[model samples]
Target: MGGPNLEVFKFGFYIMFPIGIMYYFGTNLDSKFSVDGFWPSKEQSNKIPTEPEDIRAELERLRRRRLERRATRLAEETRSQQDMAGDGA
Candidate 1:
């Protein structure tokens, strides 16, 4: 006795979704809808490549560079400590 009208709820989705879609597409008539700075054209979709592999490669390269710099800094720190220890002896 305290619920929504069944007749009004019936076919609500069939009408609501289509109307919502129409309004959405209507509002975005002349602009590009993009996600994550990557918007692919229908024809260009075949050529741009997937995000996962590219992200993996880019992350690997960045990790390698970061590790290399860390190693270099560590080596320099070790060399300075050794020189200090030798001078003290």
Candidate 2:
């Protein structure tokens, strides 16, 4: 009565078989046919500032510009909506 049943082990393997095969082939194919954006190219790498202060300043500048642009866009959208509502009334 103490002997382990082999059916349980077979079922476990059956459940894992497809998952293991997929993981293996997926990683293999990813390595073999890696596209351009998988790793950054030289020009892409060059675009990043090397100094910490420069990186921070660049990020801050980008954030400020993005916020300004977003504010302007939101302002314009609201104005247009208001104009539409006024005309419809």
Top candidate when judged by TM-score against the true structure: 2
Clash count list over all predictions = 0, 0
Displacement of residue 23 (Cα, Å) in model 1 is 43
Tens digits of lDDT, candidate 2, 1-89: 43467777778899999999888778878667768687877877857788999999999999999999999999999999999999999
Candidate 2, residue 25: Cα displacement in angstroms equals: 40
Alpha-carbon RMSD, each predicted model? 9.8, 6.4
lDDT of 1 by residue, 7-88 (tens): 5676697789989988988886557464554776777775443699987887798899999999999999999999999999
**Candidate 2 clashing pairs, residues 3+ apart or interchain:** none
Best by lDDT: 2
